[model samples]
Target: MAQLRYIYSMPVERIVRYFNDNGFHVNKATANGLLSKTADMFENLYTALGRAVLEDNYISCDETYYKVMDRTGNPDALNINKEYIWAMFAMNLNLAYYFYENGSSRGDVIHKKLEKYKGTVQSNGYAPYKSLRGEILRVSCFQHCKRKFLDLQGNPDADKIIELINRLYQQEHKHCIGADEWTQEDNLKWRRKYSKDIMKALKVALKRIISSPEYPPKSQMYTAANYMLGEWKGLENIFSSGIYKLDTNTIERLNRYISLSRRNSLFFVSHRGAERGAIFYSLACSCRLGGINSFEYLSDVINKAASLPPDTSLEKYRNLLPDKWSKK
Candidate 1:
């Protein structure tokens, strides 16, 4: 019932209706209680997944907004009605973790979450991401840079920049043929050999447009060029390793499930409900990524979790993760 509600985006009332139609009478409160209890069972495993993500070397980060009914009387709570849900995806491990901290999207929330992280973090170069601490190597999204110019369709300068960007992607596609068979060294060599020059040419073109007096500072062309130039370092970080993608497309694609759920169910009734939804969303999406049936996985784990001690070892919880559970 919980899986149907969260993973399948079925509202509780609709779920109850389906049950009643099948000759099983269930109330909305009972359905909500089941969801709460299932979330309690999955909470420990969710924490374990988060720890694993923080320990990973490569992570993609993104955030989306949600509406929450705030009953908290605190006047200074930032954007009480509008909350943000952040996602961290570990590419190497095929793991994902979602976080909702008091319905806050402030820099402090993310800064504290990633305080101990020390590896490459890929994002769209949002301002809050720039403020993250630790040994984090920030990588910007090329698609974001491309979109800036894409929005200025008729401008010749923007079109030229877009053409150069397309060439880089073409080279990337050519090298990615049978990429599953590629070694780290092979990926490194291909990027250095084929992509290096194209990136150099693109950089030069961006600088030329930035320095041109014809395009005013406030013009769309100038803004696009400046934005790309400002994010140049992060964009160039792609060549550092073949493991890095040109954008946060993978995580962004995963975020669609959150969007789907939001569109169907709308706002969470409280902060606690939002947090529980995060746990379900994290585990459900990770199950999808690992090609596991989420319903079966959740059913098994929820039972296993019930039989375990409250002080169960971290290893026990980790074994319940989607990838780990699928292997058994």
Candidate 2:
């Protein structure tokens, strides 16, 4: 299992060639079987880990495009949509899982999948999770919130926007740093003061954008301006809540793996394949982050899933979690 995990984490050609060359020297049929099974095994391994996730954790999610070959055609290639990610939160601090699918994810898709999530979720200005209402507290990623003003940094008119956003960040970072000895309650209170600062900036930015010649409804900056306008409320959610740190760096860090894997492998065969890939990537990536040997984790899980009794199958899996493994 460890070997497979290691290979999946490797370049696709490397994985294919390793099996193909090594397989030919041994037995053709068996080697071909190994080669064919590589992607699928990886798919299952990821599903196992993703299913093992818990519900109470805060999650950060985002989607990116994956381009793949169209299986239905001959001599013609088309870009098929796959997943960039389906990440979950393990703790308040770390990214637990990242699932990569090969299609475009809409707001409804995100909403349906996350319906059971009970904790707060942090994301950029994606619309899917926007309308969902429940125990889930929604927070906007601060980095994205600041991006508009950051873009406006040289425009002079947007200088106030930049100043306010930066000030909020500086305030939070400073307070958190100086607050090493403070209680959680005090920390929450310490940060609450900046809630209005974000609103102030937003209002000012909006008025300027609306009155300017670049209102976006008819300008080249339309998409950027429109996205910011649509996401203003979500972005402001950060200050209203104390638990959320102002950035989606947690999930964006998860995006780095997506960037890595996709940069090399190209795309998936189908959306279904993409979905499974997402699950696998999530588990495998999480394993790497926790310093767990991903192959060992996958191999053990696959073997155990086949033979273990239902009652003990899951417990056995949990026992092997990286955090748990560390204690043993």
Candidate 3:
């Protein structure tokens, strides 16, 4: 099942065929039954990963949509419902948590997921983040801001803004010696000396673009300039702290597998199935983030969780986490 889901990402039909070809005569029904039963074990790993992600002083979050079979009958509803799969991971730590939200209410769901979190959350400039401004430090992704202007390439004002942002990135690239080699204090010093000046220039460029006659109200340039101006504080937050990242590109890269799985399998049969998939994906990502072997990590986690009492507390479960268990 782990091989089919995590390694190959094989659908049920393909999984059954692979087993049958290997001399095991398991059919699709049998394969699915086994898969469903493993949800409990997957939940154990997912819950542990979630706790670790929330405990971090910093995390990056993003969500993608997936189709689910709908049981509800709203007047405006179609045969299927669009559900959101949120990926939130610790920025400095090797942990990722995937969550399934069956509705479109981003504000409430984000608040619930990050209820007690007091650290900065770096995300693409989504309006829902406005709700979290007071509760936690809101940070915007420069990559996202740059992408918006990249779409309007012919405009001079847009080109200037992009050039300014490029300079900041160049400064970052110059100092980066990989996280393993670079000291945080040195990194902070470089950013303060160089990146801060470029950001100040970018701010001035943004105001110029907003005031320019070339950027009419409701135009794409106007919208892009407005967004950058509105989220300036968040974008500037990275300069204030060495720990803050320039973008949420790390978590965005992790979402590639989710996209691949969705394209292949189409839609989950049920919400329960979707949640189970989230559990598996979370554990799989946790393994990748921690540099642990997925097969070994999943096998050990399932085995250890099964050996314990069903009523075990989160503390006991934490010991079995990949980062913790790997040391043992």
Candidate maximizing lDDT: 1
Looking at candidate 1, what is the lDDT of residue 75? 50
Q: For residues 162-270, could you state the per-residue lDDT of candidate 3 as single tens digits?
A: 8988888787887664666887788888889997678778888888888989779789998998998888888878888766788888898888877877777777777
All candidates in order of TM-score, best leading: 1, 3, 2
Which scores higher on lDDT, 2 or 3? 3
lDDT of 3: 0.79
Pairs in clash, predicted candidate 1: none
Encode model 2's per-residue lDDT on 1-328: one tens digit a residue: 2244223445545555665666634343453355346545444434445455544466666666666555565546565544445566554433366544334466666676677777777777766767867777777765775575566567654566667667777777665533566655665786777557666766766666766765547653444456666776767666665566777776676666666667676765566556555655665667666777776766665554455554554455555555454422
Alpha carbon lDDT at 161, candidate 2: 61
Positional deviation of residue 29's Cα in model 1 after best superposition, in angstroms = 1.3
Ten contiguous residues minimizing lDDT sum, candidate 2: 1-10
Q: In candidate 1, how many Å is residue 196 off?
A: 1.8
- Residues 1-328, candidate 1: write the lDDT tens digits: 8678767888788899999999999999998898998898888889999998888899999999888878677655644477899999998889989999977888888888899899999998788887777799998889989999999878888888899888888887776634678776787788889877888888889888888999889988988898888888888888899778888999998898888878888788889999999999899889888988888888788888899999998888988888789533
Q: What TM-score does model 3 achieve against the real structure?
A: 0.92
TM-score of each: 0.93, 0.76, 0.92
The lDDT values for all models are: 0.86, 0.59, 0.79
Backbone clash pairs in model 2 (N, Cα, C under 3 Å; residues 3+ apart or in different chains), count: 16
